[model samples]
Every structure is written in structure tokens, then in C-alpha cells.
Target chain A: MEFTNALSIATPELIVVIGAMVLLLVGAYGGDKARPAISLLSGLVLIGAAVASATGPLGQAFMGAFVNDSLAVFAKVAIYLASAVAILLGHGWMIRNNQARFEYPILILLAAAGMSMMASAGDLISLYVGIELQSLALYVLAAFNRDDAKGSEAGLKYFVLGALSSGLLLYGASLIYGFAGSMAFDDIAAAAAGAHGTSLIFGLVFLLCGLAFKISAAPFHMWTPDVYEGAPTPAVAFFAAAPKLAALVLIARTLGEGFHVIEDQWRQVILALAVLSFCVGAFGGLMQKNIQRLLAYSSIANMGYALLAIAAGTTVGVKAMLVFMVLYMVDVTGFFACLLALSRGGRPITQISDLAGLKQDRPGTAIVLTMLSLSVLGMPPFAGFWAKVYVFGAAIQGGLWIFAALGLAASVVAAFYYLRLIKLMWFDPSPGLTDPAPRDAQWVAYAAAAFSFPLVLFALGWLDGFAGTAARALGLG
Target chain B: MIAAIAFYVLAAVSVFAALRVVLASNPVHSVLWLITAFFSAAGLFVLMGAEFLAMLLVVVYVGAVAVLFLFVVMMLDVDFVKLREGFTRYMPFGAVVACILLVEMILISAAVAARGAGAHAPGVQHATDVTNVEAIGRVLYTDYVYIFQAAGLVLLVAMIGAIVLTLRHRPHVKRQDIHTQVTRDRKKALAMTRPETGAGVRPEDLV
Candidate 1:
């Protein structure tokens, strides 16, 4: 009976894992000939996981090591769906390049399963397991094109650095468990809320260091640009979307649920990270030529905003983070999708200047790419603008006006690069005609672009209410 | 007490062996030094009354891990000297990293020193009658069953990831067809050809 309840609560993750195993069997038997079917089935499985997450038996189970509350459900749905889009995007690119192996979709499916586990993680053990599962798959995806030297380097660097960070995280977890005598967040909270020790603070700081590395916050973000620049384009798109949200949600849970009493201590560390991330992301992006590297910097800056919102440590703050992340996830994925769709003379576009003649060649892709850029830069009439507004409002409400001002300044500097991209796309002389866009990538780009602008207005009311309910799930006023 | 003296001698040798493991110029020497360090660490664990953990340390780290390191060092023809040539070029960056680590260490020490006697655990006690292994098993089976499974999944992912990254199937390679092999019967296998007792079957007759 106990096992049944736990499995019932973990149904969404189980669905994804079981579906992936079944797909793996099919792929293994049918070989490379079954890749396309496997990819489509994987996407459907992710959508199924999202649906299950949405319609759920919301409760905590597994000895309170997993929670299926509003917050986890909301984050899990976004993660699963974004990863589904990633699978669709990868399928098209893989076929075009003849790297369409069946393992690709299954790896993605498993990674998505791991990310959902991160969303629902209620204890440190689940948290570490979830992170490792996702990361091990991603390390392979980074080097998916094993023949490419840059891809292999990216994979090795990511794996080595990621292992170090995991070590740091585990060390902190051990310290916390040693001090508190439990791995469950509630027990940590119960012990920490009363007679806290500085060791607990130290553990929290180390834990934050590891979590900050996950979001690619400044001072721990050395690997982001290289990994992004070197990984396959579709895989880069996947990296830019779901993993950031999963990491941020994990950070919020660890801080909000487990260490809220010491918010004063953790907030300072978060703010420092936020401030450094803002400056570094803005200035570093200005010098990047590779579009993937530029987006890496952009993600770093966006994480700074998410950190600022989290530093507020309020219900409104968590709500702001949710809004920003979901919106940003869509925009970034679309932007990369646009990159995936367009090519010049059969060569994939990797450089910013490669987009110069895109307007004349593919007007639809050019237009939508511009919309995504505007949305990410927080221009009016786009989804990202409201995301920024909510973030800043939360900051100001939490007496972080100075930080909000810093975010604005960073946004202004960030706009310079976005405009440079636009100027090149629209004004520069034609390089040459691009290859025709693939159906799947073209559609995903269009849908995401549409979501970033007109559709977002409709989504805003529902998303805000949804985000509010999720914020309330943490039991913070 | 002799227990105190044993602890000091073990600790000193462990630290020295660890330093040698890093500073050894030869890869083979490094592996040997690493094994020594592991042995000393296991000895230290023994002195601390964690005999089970000490046995595990020797069995896992010394017997398995150190031997694996030795195999990798001997089998791979990595140019260690060439690799170290860039160490000087990266000296400044390395120094900065070292300084940052130093600061972190100091700060942590300060935090602990400032909070001296107040740092006590909430207290996790095992029954005095049960061994430590049994105590661990009780929690692992009851409260941590989900975590144990999740860890298994993590290992599974790691295995899958390694295989995916390394495994490649070359196209056009001829392979066995199991279905064809298994479904063959006596009717398909034998033509019931009778040859003369001293004569060999011709190629056409075999076909």
C-alpha cells in the first residue's frame, strides 16, 4: 500500500521513464531504420508526461522525498513540453545531417525524466540523483557528434567540471545531513529554524555555489560559452531551454523550502552572483561572433534576473521567476530553432554575420527571429517585456530597487547586441541564398514566435494566476 | 595512550603519501603512492573503530581503483612532459585559482572557529545492539528506498551515456541472422544425397 501511494505520486516521471524504455526496445530491435518513428514517439511521450503532470494526484510521498504540488507540476509541465520541442527540433536536424541514430531521442527522453525529477525533488538524495541523471545524458549529447573535435572537448570539459560541481554539492549535502541528521527538507527546516549553526550556513553557501554553477551564473560560468559554441545546434537549443528552468527551480526549492530561515545569509550570496552575472553577461556578449556563444551570454544575463527575483524571497518573487523562465525558455528555443532552420549554400549558420542575408532569402524566418530577439530584449508588445516588469516589480517591492536598476542597465547594454543582430539581418548586403527551412523546425519557430508576442497576451492572465498558485504552494506569504 | 600514538603515525604517513601521489614525476610512481595513501587511510579508519569501512577502503580503493589507475598509466602512451610544458604558461591563472581556494578555506575555518562548541548535530542514534551495517540497512530499506532506486537510475544513465558516446556500428558489416538460423529444419538441412563410400561429394552435389 505504501509503495502504491509513492508510485502513484511519481506517475508522471514513471510514465516518461517507462515510455523511454519501451521506445528504446523498439529502437534497439528496429535499428537505425526506426529512428524517425522513435523520435516522434518520444515527443508524444513527453507531451503525455506534461498532461499527467497537469492532471495529477497532488501530494508528497516516498517518505516526503518527492512532492507533486502545484509548483512542481507547473515547472514539470514547462520542462517536459520544452524538451518535447527540443526532440522535434533534433529529429529534423539529425535527418538533414544523417546523424539520425535511435539513441538520440531516448537520451533526450531520459534527460527530460531527470529534469522532472529535479522539479519534484523533496530531499537532497533525490536532488543529487536527479541532477546526475540529467547531466550524464547531456554530457553525451554535448559530444553527440563524436567525430567532431570541438564536440568531444565540450563533452570532456562539461563532464569534468560538472563532476567537480557535483562533488561540491554532495559535500555540502553531507555537511547538512551531519549537522541536521536528516536529508529531508522539512527536517532540515525544523532543526534549522530553531538552533541554527554556522556549519549549516557554510553548507548552504557551498550548496548555492553548486546550484549557481548549474544556472551558469557569473564566477562559475566559464564553461557556458565553450560548451554552447561547440555542441550540435539542436542540442544547444535543448541546453538553452529546459535545463536552466530545472536548475532554477531546484535552487528555489533548496532555498525556499529548506533554508528560508537563513534567507538573510543566502540572499547576499545570490545578490552577489546576480550582480556579477549581470555585468559579465552584458559585456561578454558584446564581443561574441558565434550566435550560440552570444545566446549563452544572454542566458547568463537572464539567470541574473531570475536570481534577483529569487533573492527577494517572497511569493511575488517566486511568481516573477516562474513567469520570466517560462517566457524566456520559449523565446530562446525559438531563436535557436530559427538558427537550426536556416543555412547558406548547405552550410549551417554558426556565426552572427551568417544571418546577414537571411531577410532576403527567408523573409518568414527573418521576421520571426526579429520578434524573438525583441521579446528576449524586453521590448514592448512582447512576452519578455512583462517578464522583466514582474521581476523588477518584485525586486522593488522587496526593497531591491538598486538591483532592479542594475538589471535595467544590464538590459540596456544587452540591447546593443540584439540590435546589432537585427541590423545585420535586415541592413547588411546579401551573402547568398539560404537552404530551404525544414518543416518541423520552421513550425516550431513560428509557434514559439507567435507565443512570444500575440499569443502571450492571452496567456498572460492564465499564466499569472497559475504562477501565483505555484508560488503559494511553497507556503510563503 | 598507544591509540593516540597510532592515530598520529597513521595521519602523518597518510598526508605524506598523499603529497607524494601529487608530486610524483612518474605516473607509475604516482599510482604506487596513491595506493599507499589509500592503505594509510584504511589504517586510520581501523584506528577509529570503523573496521568495516576500513576493509571497504582497502578492497575498493586500494585493490580496485589503484589497480585501474596503474593499468591506465601503463597502457596509455600519454606524453606527460609535453602536457606539463603548458603549466608554466598557465601559472598566473593557476595562482589566482589557488589564492581563491585559500581564501575560501580561511573563511570556512573562521566560520567554524567562531561557532566552536555550538555546532552540534540533532542526533542520529543507532541501537547499541545492532551493528553499523545493520543500522544503515534499516534506513536504506525503509526511508531511503526511493533514493536507492534513483541512484540506480543515475548509474544506468551513466552507462547508457558512455555507450552512446563511444559505440558505433559500421554499416555494411555482415552479421548473423538469428531467425534464419533458428528456424531451419531437417527438411531444409538435408538433401538425403547418398554418395559412394570412397568418393567425395562434388561442389555441385553439395549445392
Candidate 2:
């Protein structure tokens, strides 16, 4: 890996890194004066990086520690775009709450860069580095509102648990390296093919555990509710969207590419995780009064659906995973945008009751939220429905009928909560949350809402085709 | 035979210190025990022929991390009784978790051992002439360069996060407003005029 080659391959991350560092210095010196400019610049930098990442030629770099491929490009673009929108949605909230510090955007940029790295990671070392980079920034972002005790508590909890998971991940990587005699995915796959030793199986289990924790799969999703409820709404929005996408991709890479030789073992583990996650996500969200926590549970359940495709252990399964992730990104981005608009008197409207009669107050916003919720429920004609179709289709195609059936049941259970939210908006009497939606939130809300629709027309051919192409590029097919 | 004896001594000391780190009642003693554990672990690393790792363990763990732990233990006013109170209440669950972890470790080690001796070595290949640090440098700089930079970014985020959490400006506190003072002009900030020496400062001038 020559210097220039590495630079070219890592242009997206480098752009974000350089931009974040410069803005960090500028923010430090400029103080309160340069906050808005820095934030705007942060969004632009993300967009620029997204463009850079999308245009780059596909190849491996840094002795195969870093890869530039269609899969990486797709994941990076989703992360960068979702993060950029998240920044925009969060900007108004940060300003309103006096939490618009320069560090907020810089940390977001760093996290996005880390996500990009995760998308492109080719080896265990790179994977660990990417996960840590993203987690560290997220730990800060989770507690960005330091004045709030809940925020501090969320940050601390996330940090401790996150650190533990990272330790587990690193230990697993080390174990795998020991067994395989290499850290590269190719060599690990070769080693795994040769023999299925107990150590190798244990290492794979630990690795899956760590990845499951990252994606908030059940049994490891303890932190999701508290962190979501405690963190700023905008940060939570970003949290619910981008990190899950990146983590899912990394799981695909690690398991599908690296540990594919032991597909039987890993597939069972993934199926069990997916089952638990679906049940937990569905049942957990039912009693949630806090809307954020409710969304948190929904996220867990959604991740379960996403994991189903990967559990199929086929190229089409990977393709379905990509499709599911892209649709999820759209739905979550819209959902959070609507959430941002639901605030009143500079304080976020966190309670489900706070959204009472939202339809009368802000009909357009309410309708958009209803649509996003419907999509999330996997109702027909929405992106979320198609996302589910592809994943369940892949599962059935791979003969995982039990998993697919359980997933369908979970979707029905989860739909109740989504419908309840919509019902509260349209039928429930007014609680006087008449404050207008924040500036710039409407655009994001509309864009996300628009994407959530038109799925039926495009998903089967275009989106599936695109995801299939990317999955093939990774040698999945 | 001497080398084997040294390795056994280091390993036993490390294991003992590690147990003491958890069992010791006093927080200060626990920190000290942790340092001992770290030192003996470094010795074990050195015995394994990874001198670079040994140096790092000593420098990073013993030198910096343990000292920081000691300072924190001494600085905080901790309620040892309260800390131990939950021990009995949570003992069953904690013990179950601990037992599970122990079992998992035993299983992993047993499996590794079953795989035979070659599995114990590090994966990276190196020239015999190269030093441990040099070999590490080669791999880290070439193969792991991006990861190294990512680690640096992680540290940067941690630094900024700490500062963000602790730094605050109270509104009521009287602090120098450098910008206001520096921007002030003589005409706006001061009234200068000729006056009789005996007149001193007038009330209007003071106002």
C-alpha cells in the first residue's frame, strides 16, 4: 500500500477527519460565534465526503486492511447522508437547548468517518479500530447535554457497556487470529474452511456477541432504551439510524465473508439472536410511555428483521440485508425528523401523550409521521413493507421458514404500537402542543416521508438490483 | 530450568495479585494490588519473548493506568460499606455470571490447548534479526496504519468529551470581558477634560 494509494482509497474518511479537525480548532478559538458556520460546514463536509466515497474506484488498500467496493460505497453513502440529515435536524434543537457546542458536529463527523471505516474494514484490526472510533464519539454524543443528569447517566452507561463489548470484540478477534494464524478475512475464511475447532467456534460466538451488541440485538440491548431516552432527540435520531446500518454491514462482512465456512454454526446463532431480538423489540415497546424508548425498542425489532436476511447465509441474503438497511435508513431518518418537529417550548416532547391531537395542530407533519409509522409497521405500499418482504423472502428462499414465520408474527405485534401512535395523533383530543415545527425540520421530514412511499414501484427492480449488484461485487454471489 | 522457574514465579505472583485486586477491602490496597498484578503480567510477557509488549504493559498499565487508578481511589470519598452491601443482594446473579464466564474461559483454553502448540504464537511473521519493537513497527506502520490513526482519533474524542463535560461558565460569576474591554475606545469609555488640581474628581465625572 503506497502512501498515495492509501490516501486515495481513504479519501472519504480523510475528508471528514481533516474537516472535523479544522472545525474543532476553529470552534475552540471562535467560541460561541462560529457555531452555526461550523455546523453548516460539517454538513457540507459530510455531503462532500459522501460524494468522494461514491465516486472512488473500487479496490483494496493498505495491504487489504481497507477495502473500497460497492458494498462499502453503499454503506458509506447511507451513513454520510443519514448523518448529514441528522445534523440538520439536530442543529435547531442544539441551538434551542443551548447545547450547540462545536464539539457536537465534530463528534458527529468523527462518528460518521468511523462508520465509513467500518463499512470498508477488511481485517479484524480495522474492524476494531472502526468500532472504537464510532463508539467513542457516540459515547460523547450520547452525553452531549452534560447539564442534564439523565444525559450524563446515559453517557456513563453507554461508555461502560460499550467498553465491555469492545473488550469482548477484541478478545474474539485475538482468539480468531490465534486459530486462523492471520487477521485478514480471506485467510480466516481459509482457516475456518480447513477445520471447525472449538476455539474457532467460541471465537465466532464471541465475535457475533459483540456485533449483536452493536446492532442492539436482544439480550444485549439493555442500553438502548436508557441511552435513547437520555440522549438529545437529534442524537437519538442519528443513533437509531446510521450506526445500526454500519454495524449490520460489518456483521455481514465479518460473518458472511470471514466466517462463511462455518455457516451452519453462525446461521443458527444468528437465527436465535434474530428470534430473541424480534420478541424483545415487539413486547418491549408495548409498555413504553416515552416515545424515544418506544422507538428504541422498534429499532431493536427492526434490526432483528434485518438480521434474518444475513442469517440466510446466501448471496441473496446479503443483498436483502442491504435493501433492508437502505429502507430502514430512510424510515428512521423520517421518523426522527418528525420527532424533532414534535418539540414544544424548547423542550423535547418525549411522552406519547404529548403528541395528542398533533394531526389538528400540524396536519402535514402528523400525516408524515403516520406514514413513517405505517412503513415501520411493514404495512403495504411503504418502504418498510418491501424491506420486510425482501428479508423474509430471502429467509424462505434459504428454507428458514420458522424464522420467517416468527418474524411475520413479530411484525404484527409491532404494528399495534405503530398504529396506536397514529391513532393518538388523529383521534385523541388536543393537549395543546400547538408550537410550530422547527425551521428546516420540515424538509427532512418530507424527504424521508417521500422516500418511504414509492417503494412498491421501485423496490422489486431498482433497489433490489442495486443491492444485488453490490452484494455480487463483494463476491457473495 | 531457570527460565521456567522465573516464568512460574511471575505467573503465580500475577495471579495472586489479580485475586487480591478484587478481594482487598481497602480501595487503596486494591489499586496497589492492581499495580503488582500489572508488573508481574509484564514479567510474564517478557518471558514470552515479546519484549515490546512487556515494555508497553509496564509503561502503559503499571506506569500510567495504575497510578491514575491510585490517585482516583485516594481522591474520592468512597463508602466501602455501601459498595459491599450490594454484594450479598446481588451475589447469586453475580456468581452465576462469573461462573459462566469461568466456564467459557476454561472451554476456550481447553480448545486452544487441544489445537496444539503452534496456536499459541502470534500470527505475524517476522525476520529473526528484527527486534520485537521493530517488527511491531513494521506491521503497525504498513498494515495497521489506518487503525493506528483511528486510535489517535479515539483519544482525541475522549479528550474533547472530558473537557465538554466539565467545562462550564456560570452567568453570575464576575469574569474579565476581554472582548468588551479591548473593543472599548477612549471616547466611549472615558471622559477626559482639563480640571483644576484642587477640584479633584467631580461627582458627575465619577458617574
Candidate 3:
């Protein structure tokens, strides 16, 4: 019975792993012709994994190393969905540029599997393993365009910094394990709940720092702009969407599950990171010419807003965090889709100036960019507005009025960059005649952007209920 | 008494070698010092009764990781002098950071030692008759199997990542497709018609 229970709990990850392996074998021998089929297969595999995870019973497996619960289900489904969209959109772009390789989808599948593991991780060992698994694939994906020196440099920088952060996290984990005498989240929480210790607090600090780096929050966010600017556009899109969700969920889980007792300590640290991220994200992008770098800063700031909910340390905070992640991912994927669609004379455009007079041609892409930009700016009736509402409202309920105020001010400042991009797309004259949407995959991305409109406007109640249910299931409520 | 003496000797050598690993001007020498440090650390592990970990340290770190370090250092043509040019400039800042870390570690360890009862839970008691390896194997294969498999996945991803990052496609290289070559028919290669006797097959006739 126990064996079957474990198998059932792990079915989703197993399906993804098996699918990836099969695709790897098929892709290896099938040559370049297999890319499209494999890409489609990988997408289906992720959807299947999501379904499996959602249908599973809520409980723990692997001696409490992996948790199968509403929270895990929600996070895994979101990750798989976002990753599937990335693969669907990225395939056509890669193929059009003669950069299509079977490895792209395989890596995505592996990365998704890692993220699903992270979503369900019930212990620190699982967390570290999941994180490393995800990051290793991401580092390769970031440097996918090896011919580009900047891409290689980005990969190297990400790898080195990521490894350093991983080391710090391990150190912190060891400290906690030493203090608590167990690596399990429940044990650590119990140990802390029994009596607070300085060692446990230090461990939590280091752990939070490591997670902050993962999410590219403030002082630890030095690598975000350069990496985003240099990595291939699809990889950047993936980076901005799914991995951020996974990392954010992991943070919520680590703090909520393992260190909830020390909320007084960790909340302050999170608050500092949140404030700094908001400031840097707001002020950093004002002078940026590169579109990717601008978005990177925007993402940093967005992370700050999400961290506000985390700082609240309440059930409402957890629910708001979930809703915000889903909405933010939608906006990120849509924005990247527009960027991916932009090309003139077969050369990819990376500059904010490149969008100048884009409204004249490729009006579909221009409009999509407009909506996503508005959404990112937290304009009312857009999805980002509600995402912000939940987070800010939760903060206020938790007596974190100062953070909410800081967030509101930061949003106003951050609006300028998002609006500037829109203005460039609409008002400014084209530096050269703009090109039409160049790839079939971009239409899929446009469809994604289109879907977000209804999602933001009509799906608000569903998102709220789902997030609330998941949070309640996790006992945060 | 003998174990204490052995532990002290290993600890001293390990610390010295670790210092040399950082301070050595040549990368190759640094790698060599790193190997020494790893070996002494393994020795210390043995002195602490973790035989499996000690053996693993020697096998994995000394055997594979140290060799990898040596390979990397040998492969790169680094200018040792240029690399060290910033040493003096950063020394004070580095020293300050080091001192802070040292203080933090000392404080943490001191506190942990003082509150020793809180450091170990009574729940993880093990049978004394079991060897370390046997005990580890039992738990790892049972309770930790999933995590162990996850570690394997990390390694697999690492391998794939390394290959994808370094492997380059040589566009100019032409390779034969054996399947196509073998499937080629005799009819496609040769004309079946009989040629006119004695006259050289005209180009049209050949076709």
C-alpha cells in the first residue's frame, strides 16, 4: 500500500522524466527533422504532468521529502503551463533562425521536471537537488547561442553566481540541520516552534539571501540585466516566467513550512529585500535602452511586490502570492512573445528604439505589446492590477501598511519605463521600415497574450478561490 | 590518545594545504595544494569514525574532483602575475570580510556547543551493531531513494548541459547517410537498356 501510494504521488514527475528520456532518444537519432514533433511531444508531456499532479491525493511521500498537496498541485500546474507555452512559442522562432535543436525541448522538459520537484519538495535536500537540477538546465539554455560571445559570457556568469548561491544555501542548510538535528521541514519547524535559536535565525537569513538571488531581488540582482540582455530571447522569456514562479513558490514553501515560527526575524529580512528590490527595479530601468534589461528591472520590481505578500506571513499573503505569480507569469510570457515576434530583415531586434513606429507594421504585435505593457504598469482592469490588489490588500490586513505604501510609490515610478516602451512602439517614427510578424510560433504567443485579457478581467474570482483553497490546504489559513 | 594525536596532525596539514591553495601563485600548485587539503580532510573524517564518508572523500574528491581541477588548471594558460596584481589592492577589504566570517563561525559554533542538548534529537537513534555503510545504505535506498534519484537527475542534467554548451556544429562537414546509401537501387544507378553494338553510347541514348 505504501509503495503504491508513493508511486501515485510521484506519477507526475515520473511521466515527465520518462517522456524526456524518450524524446532524448528519439531526438538523438531523428536528426533536425524531429524538432517539431519532439517539441509538441514535450508540451503534451508537461500538460499530462500537470493533470497528474492536480488529480493526486494530498499527502506526503518519500518519508516527507516530497509533499503532494494543493499548493504543490497549483504550483506544478502553473509551471508546466508556462513551460509548455515557452516551448510552443520558442519552437518556431528557433527553427526560423536555423537554431532549432532537439536539445531545446529536452532541456525545457528537464527544467520543468526540476521545477515540479521543487514545488513538491518537503525537505531541504529535495529543495537543493531540485534547484540544482533546474539551474543546470537553465545555464545551458541561457548560452544556447554559443556562437554569440555575449551569450557565452552570460552563461558563464549565471553559472558561477548560481553555484556560489547554491553553496551558500548548502551552508545554511547544514547550519539548520546542525541546530535542528534533522533536515526535514517539519522537524526544523518543530525545533524552532519549541524554542528559537540564533543558529536557526542565521540559517534562515542565509537561506533567504540565496532565494533572493534566485528571484533576482535587490542587492543580489547584479546578474539579471546582463544575463537577460545576452541570453537568447526565448531563454530569457523562460527565465522571466516559469523559473521565477518556481523560485518564488520555493521561497514561500521554505519560509512558510520550515521557518514560520521565526516569522519575526525572517519577515524583517524579507522587508528589506522587498524595499531594495522596489527601489532598484523602479530607478534602474529609467535610462535603459535595451528592452531586455528594462524588463529585467521590471521583473525585479515585480518580485518586490510579490515579496510584500510573503512578508505578511499570513494565509492571505500566501494566497495573494500565488495569484500574483500566475498573473505576473502571464504578463511576462506575453511581453516576451511580442519581443520574440519582432524582427526586421531577418535580424532580431533588442533595443527599445527598435519598437519605434512598430504600430505602422505588425500592428497585431504592437497591440499585444501595448496590452502587456499596460498590464505590467498595473493599469486598472488589467491582470496586474488585481495581482497588486491582492498583495497590497493582504499586506494592509497583516499590518504592513508601510510596505504597501512603498509598493504604491514604486509602481508609480516604474510606470514610466513601461509607458516609455509603449510610446516608442506607437508615437515615435520608425528608425527603419518595421517588418511584419515573421514566424508562425509568434501567433501562438499572440494567442497567449490575447488569453491574458480575459484572464485578468474575468478570471479574477477563480484565481482568488484557487489561491485561497491552496493556501488553506497548506494550513497557512 | 592516538586518535587525538592523529586528528591534530590531519587538522594542521589540512589547514596549511587549504591556505596554500589560496595563496599559491601558480594555478597548478594551487590545485596540488587542494588535493593535499582534501586528503587530510578525508583523514580527519576517518578519525571521526565516519569511514564511509572518509572513503568517499578520498575516492570522489581526491580521485575525480582533484584530477578535474588539475586538468582545468593545466588547460588554461593563465598569467599568474596578472591574476595576482589585484591581491595587494583587495587585501584589506578581503581581510576585513574574512575576519567577519571567522567571527560569525566562531560565535555560532560556540553557541551550538554551549547548548549541546538542543543540537541532537533523540529520534535518530541507530542500532550500534550495524556498520556505517550498512546503516547508510538501508536508509538511502528506502527513505531517501527519491532524493537520491533526484541527485542522479542533477548529474544527468549537468552532463547534457556540458555537452550542449561545448558541442559545435561544423556546417561544412558532409557525412554520408548509410540508410540512404544502402537503399539506393541498381535501377537508379544504371540504365537497363541494351546499347547499340560497337557504337559509343550517345548522350541521349545513355539517358
Best by lDDT: 1
Candidate 2 lDDT over A1-477, as tens digits, reads 377987998899999999999999999999989999999999999999999998987888888889888889888988998899888888888887778888888899999988988999999988998998899999999999988999999999999999889888888888888888888998888787775444577788888888898999998999999999999888998999999999999999888678877888888899999999999999999999999999999999999998999999888998999999888888888888888877777567889988889888799999899999999999888988888989999999999988999999998999999999999999999877667777688888888888888744655587777788778765754
Write down the worst ten-residue block by lDDT for model 1 chain A: A190-199
Model 2 chain B lowest lDDT segment of ten: B117-126
Which regions in candidate 3 have their CA more than 4 angstroms from the true location?
A439-441, B115-126, B169-207
Which DockQ value does candidate 1 get? 0.48
Which lDDT tens digits does candidate 2 get at residues B1-207? 988999999999999999888878789999999999989888888887888899999999889998999999899999988888877888799889989999988876776677673444445554789899888888787777778888899899889888888888886566899999889887777776788888877746744
Residue lDDT tens for model 3, A1-477: 997899888899999998998998898899788888999999999999988888877788999999988888899899998899889877888877777888998999999999988888899999999999999999999989888899998998999999989988888887788778888898889888864455698787778788788899998999999999999888899999888888888888888888888888888999999999988999999989999999999999999988999899988998999999899898888888878778887888988888899888767888888888888888877788888989999999999998899999999999999898888888999888655675654675576667568656667787788888877765664
Q: How many Å off is the CA of A199 in candidate 2?
A: 2.1
**Candidate 3 to truth, TM:** 0.93
User: TM-score of chain B, per candidate?
Assistant: 0.69, 0.73, 0.75
- Each prediction's DockQ against the real complex: 0.48, 0.46, 0.47
Model 2 ranges off by over 4 Å: B115-126, B171-207
Candidate 3 chain B minimal-lDDT segment of 10 residues: B117-126
Tens-digit lDDT string for candidate 1 (A1-477):
988988888888999999988998998799888888999899999999899989979998888999889999999999999989899999989888877788888889889988988999999989989998899889989989888899999989888989888888998898788767789898888767765545677778778888888789998999999999989899989998899899998988888899888888888999999989988999999999999999999999999999999999999999999999999999999999998998877778999988896788788998999999999999999989999999999999999999999999999999999999989989999778888888889998999999998999999999999999998888765
**lDDT winner between candidates 1 and 2:** 1
* Interface RMSD (Cα, Å) for model 1: 2.0
